[model samples]
Target: MAAGAGALAPVPGVPSASLHEFPYPPQTRPRVSGGSPAGGVPPATDLVLGATAGCLACVLTNPLEVVKTRLQLQGELQPPGTYPRPYRGVLRALGAVCRADGLRGLQKGLAASLLYQGLMNGVRFYCYSHAEDAGWTRYPGGTVAAGAIAGAVGAFVGSPAYLVKTHLQAQTLSSVAVGHQHNHESISGAFESIYRQHGVAGLWRGVTGAVPRVAVGSAAQLATFASAKDWVCEHQWFREGSWAAVLAGGMVSGVAVAVTMTPFDVVSTRLYNQPVDADGTGKLYRGFLDCVLQISSKEGLLGLYKGIGAVYLRLGPHTVLSLFFWDELRKMVQHQQPPGP
Candidate 1:
């Protein structure tokens, strides 16, 4: 009996612990820690880094963007008897612009591009970070939703700059190739000229298409980045480092943005480039829907995505480099933060 009673007592190292009857306080579980396991950059930091990268990218690629806009906008309505030339691709376009107009022509819209990209990226990164903090980062759906909202707002804010940039770029090609001349000498000049000609409405010429283009592209980018990061982090190969997360996130985001926004982008390009008569009655598109219908009617379904290949070529590298550089810059900023009391 004595041996049996001793055996019935609690074991030396084990306690018969239960929620209702535990004698001591509940044990605190050890937290898993190393890097920021949450896998998100801080909102303010993201904004700063994104803006910096966007501005830098604009400075580096403004020439290419100018050539692209020119190529996309070229066609009928130019002077009679002058054959309009089409560029083969980005490099070829660059070469042609350089040969014809020198390096200055490539930087035609530099100011507007800088302003537009800087503001757009700043808003995008800031909103993305804030949304993530508000619990959007937990799932792919939430990330996409947040990104779309951010992108829509950003597009609206950046539309004026976009309009100016496109006009400036178009003017460069038009003046040299078509003999059509405007009073605009710089981005500010273009804005003033447009305002002088058509009032506030002129600045928002293609906003109808821009909204959807930005929203869908941003949603796709954020969703892809978050989902890819999650997948990579789960795999044994990328579980150990943050660089892998950055690379995977950027690549996925680039592809998503390029694929989803191509059609809207084409419409936007055409809408911005179309000639407007003195009465503003020669508009090619009445609105976004009209633009799509007209393109499909006139140029077939493929017309709605005419410059998609070029768009992908431009956007993919831009997005990848922007995100990647932003990540690195953010990490550096975080590392420099002093410990709190």
Candidate 2:
């Protein structure tokens, strides 16, 4: 039977004409059809695994993010008082963080990152899958629309955690500076401090820029991924495996997101870290227009994309891992399902 099945399968070097059609033996079809139950793995399982992997990666790479943020936020555009650049690039930054604050420094905002990513990716994947299932996949712009909505919601839900994380990551420098003392040491500490000082509003300090950035970036990512996957599948570039589709899709998606959202990302980062007093008591960015004007006037047009390289660095691996792992997890779940509805 195995030998017969092999004979019917597509030749190893030949490209299949259609993706939906498989050149497999008739007997194998029954085995495959009988192995899995209806509905296969729950969408939530994919969410859980993707979210876990995403959060883990974020925690591991956060030191790079910290260095990137500091580099972008430098007031002088040069090292302060000849402190050996404070943090140069990824490796140098990691070394400095480890040297100064020990291993704990590398994990400065780990808790907040985990919490934020878990919520962000969890909702993102869940909503995206549901959108695909609900005939949204058939629409012309459905992928982008679904991704925009998912990202906007995720950004809002995860904003508070992000605020805490950014503040904690920034706190280390405050201690070293003269007459500048930071009290927050942990995620809870940062949250409490922000709430105590600025109430609920403080926790959402950067919502204006953040919302648009996430929406645009997410739309670009999903649209690019879907389009790329379709193209690759049509071209028979990597067999019929979902992992190959994901890899190709993720590369295009990462590049699209990074390029499209660069300006908004810079604005969002600054808005999040800016001193509230500088903009006024309650105004985070004095409206988006004013924020743009200020950044342009003070820092120049280049300032709008300050840390774009880091964005690529972080996003490349992030999107690749996310999409690839998501496909694999889905497959595993399908394989494990019982033989019933």
Candidate 3:
């Protein structure tokens, strides 16, 4: 797969080929150099690159994240049409946040967000890239499995940060507040409070919801991204190595990821931000499955899709920026390495 020639245009009147027949455009292939298989990055460097990119993206898109979280939790546990929705849409939610908490409101939980994104994507990219370097992704279905596993590991490692982030983001003023507000003063305060109340186990209280959200999201995002890139190149939509192709592929992948990920995302946010009993058990949800069942039965199926627009708005750009930055950084590092004999 790495030894491919330049992009091969589909033959006139011929059907597009499968990824099995063509894994990547030549320019997109990792060039083997020195002792690095497929010009792969060092494991530590891959982690840094992924974390750096994810954090950068997180900083820019966190406002949408704030809005999305609030939107998801706006009418929590209420039947449709039963509750007055304070945040009816993305724009309305943004306005409500600004009015209630000022511009800084949009940046709530930034510290926890950065921590989560750093750990999660760092581990995620590290694992996925290493799998590719090992040729484990050459097998059919390997890419999806590798992406899912990487996401699960990353999500678990960062679950504590995410738990704190959810609570912080959901901490709005009474007028615009939604969900079970934790009233966290800051990331450190949230962490300290949870640890004090429930011990070490409290920090990971919502990981059950987080794992599937990230795993499904990662699989959809990565799989679609690779296939979309190949499809764009095969269709001659952009020149090899063109930034346009990368952007196009990212945009396509973002839609797939948003559709597959939103339900899980909504559930994860609810789980993390739900109030807890003294024993550290969730007050509202016993576990992930119970949460799903309650949300479905009480709020209807669309409850799981709340804040979908905000989710897409945030996720699409986040996906594009993170992947683009990660890809460019990898290329830059690969170029710096000396070639093999």
Candidate 4:
């Protein structure tokens, strides 16, 4: 049976001759490079490149993330229409944050944000890069699994940074800045404070929430990007590896990620930002299930989708910038590699 199945299996390295043969084009089709290497490992250089690009993109979009976090956290567990949401809409929320917290407030967690992005995306893109090269992305389900594993591992490793980033971003800095404002002055300070207050465990407060959010988001992101790129190239929509193809792919990936991941992202923000009680338990949310239940019961079903627009806004540009950089950088490195035997 195994041999029979193998005999019928499609050759992953072959590109479809026409649209009728394959539902979508694969940018350049699978290559000899897609064959399994002895170690099945991607280069360390790709990981570093992914991290660097992610850090740059995170810095560019931190303010939007802050706004999104604030909006998501505003009416948690409150009944719909009863919560006193300070920020009205996306534009209003942006303006309100600036008005209350000042322009700098928008970029509250730059350090933590960069740190999380570096770690999270480093692992994510690294894993996807390997998966792509290994021909795992040739199948839709394989792509999601590869992305999910990568995202889960990355989110777990980067949980502490993510916890800090959420905390710093959620704080609504009062104009007065008086009476012990929640100011995360530095990453070290944040780490030290959380450790002293909640012990070592506190640092990774909402890893459970983060894992699914990132995993689902990453899966959607990588799969959609690949498909979009393939579709564009198959139809001659854009030159392979060109900025145009990258941009189009990123746009589709960003929307798919935002739509699929928003609810989990909302939960993650809430769990991370919610005040920890004396027993080291979340005051507003007991756990992932509890949070979901409370939000549904009190805030209505839409509560799960709060700030979706804000999520899309941030995710779109972030996906574009990071993928653009990664693709361009990878192409450069590939060009520089010596010819193989």
Candidate 5:
């Protein structure tokens, strides 16, 4: 789970008392043949591992990501639950997209999605692992704040990729002309066009919104994953270090992430994709709070939770795969290292 800036308020229902326990055996920290300044394995190991896991998961669920983006951006100004809106819900939205543009429509932003995930999670996991190794995440209390800081750093770096991804996903001819379908045909082209049009600042269009979204998501995900896995191990729910424990912990994390992230995710998508005039003022949302207020008033509370199904589908398996892979990689690293002096 995400780990150590400020105290992360306890996740409701998880006992605070036992959250400090580490699930894995505590071996003495060892020196490395090639390592970071810390004398242990370089934190870049986590970066590479996270990117591997993120890119792999992105390929599998890009369709869901595309669909989820569309769902969030769809019907923004339209009345809640209204038909004649291009997309209404999961099944209807999926059918509408396929019928209009074919299955390729759902894959609209796959490239950007993969690139963004690699950039974002690479930094995210790298930062979190460092904090964990330093014992910042020795307890659950600091997990969320730690994740927020790491998430913000990663989001800032990857904002352009995410902006491109959202623009591609939000494209539909019917409604939401307020949101643009970019003319660029490739990822590089998209990046170039945005830079040429808006300069360096243009590429980071929604970073303000993205930072909180990712921070909350990372914290909710990693903290719960670590705690749940530890709890499962303590009770012998599954053999320690087994996939079963990993999967169980990941599942718990998915729910927390979904609940914490959807609102901020919506804000990030809108801020990123909303069309701006030559002067760069958003036509749809005045700002993040305005977007939430408008959505809440017009679409009701459920508006905040749009695309939740697609979120769960994408995030659940993603959390499972990434955590499982990261855990296994760490175990392998520990295994290969000689005993600490």
Candidate 6:
């Protein structure tokens, strides 16, 4: 998914081919709508649609997100075999959380998850849609560039929510807890505590890690999806506008996103969840570069890919569902609109 960005379940399909065979859709071109310079759904509508899709996907995929967060933080800065691996694998991790915190524990950060997904994807989709409508996506690499910009903007906007979500998800009983425990009692409490302790700046902490994480994820996700759609159609594996094509594209996008985003995801999670000093600076890492250097040196390169399986598992279905819902919702809204005079 998009640095947790977007995700899709695996679909049965063939690989994509040359862009020459499948030109960009004409409808994707810019247009004047309601006397405003925009394309497709209005920016506001796109925001709502994206948020709705993201929230829906988050609900379904949050359990995996929780597990993935714990897995990533389990043995921070420690050698692989040196740490106690309480959560051995995905299923085992889930089982461990369930046993320790019960069924509700699996949904530890539901509120924060919804808040983050809705805000992040809303801004991401809105910005990307705006860029597309402005003709920025018409260039050779415009789509990826636009996607990255949109995702970075979205990540910045939603960093506070992500910060809270990470803390909440990692808030299991100390016995099985990994990383620093913020021990936030509730979402509101977490916000209050951080703000009271660190002021407004504290809320935006770790944004440095989040922006790139989502930018890379969104870029790869959108680009691959576009290409995969063409590939599926070129091979006659699925009709151009059919559901099968969408699923195939989503599956390919999911794989590309997971591979590209995992390392950033790990860094972002650490930056967000690590304990902060009296001045609100990260105790473990002074900044993004320092975090990377320390992680690579202390834990080795594989440390960067701590929770790849959980990331992919969460990403695949989340991307597919979020995109499917987003498009369907847009179509529905567009249909209900009155024709232009």
lDDT of all predictions:
0.59, 0.58, 0.75, 0.67, 0.68, 0.79
lDDT by residue for model 2 (1-341), tens: 00000011122223344322331111112123543214543446646865765675575557666655655565422223433356565666667667777778777777887787777777666565555545464466655676678777767777787767666666665433211124476778788878888788878888786777778887766555545545677787765555566466455556667677777776776677766663235343576667777767766777676656667566655665554455456567667776653
For residues 157-227, write the lDDT of model 3, one tens digit per residue.
99999999889989977877789989888888889999999999999998998988988887776566656
Better of 4 and 6 by TM-score: 6
The regions of model 4 sitting more than 4 angstroms off are 1-41, 130-140, 175-182, 228-249, 335-341
Error of 3 at 221 (Å): 1.7
Model 5: runs farther than 4 Å from truth? 1-40, 172-179, 226-245, 328-341
For model 1, state the Cα shift of residue 42 in Å. Answer: 6.2
Model 1 alpha-carbon miss at residue 325, Å: 2.9
Candidate 4 local Cα displacement, residue 236, angstroms: 10
The model with the greater lDDT, 4 or 5, is 5
Q: Is candidate 2 or candidate 6 better by TM-score?
A: 6
Candidates 2 and 4, the one with greater TM-score: 4
Cα lDDT tens digits for candidate 6, 172-226: 8878989999999999999999999999999999999999999988777766766
For residue 315, give model 2's deviation from the true position in Å: 0.9
Ranking by lDDT: 6, 3, 5, 4, 1, 2
Clashing pairs in 5: 1-222, 1-223, 2-222, 2-223, 4-146, 5-146
lDDT of candidate 1 over 252-304, digit per residue (tens): 55555666676777677677666687755435667778777876766567555
* Model 5 per-residue lDDT tens digits across residues 1-341: 11111112234345544443222212223434454423334568768867766777677667777778888876676676574466666778788778776889878878888788888878876786666557665454555666678888878778899999888776765543224566667788889888887888889887778888887887676566666666777888887666677666666666777788888887788888887777666787878788889888887888888887777667766766655555566667656766543
Off by over 4 Å in 3: 1-38, 229-245
Please name the candidate that would achieve the greatest TM-score relative to the true structure: 6
Model 5 residue 24 lDDT score: 26
Error of 5 at 228 (Å): 4.6
Pull out the clashing pairs in model 2.
none
Residue 134 local lDDT, model 2: 57
TM-score of each: 0.73, 0.74, 0.86, 0.80, 0.81, 0.89
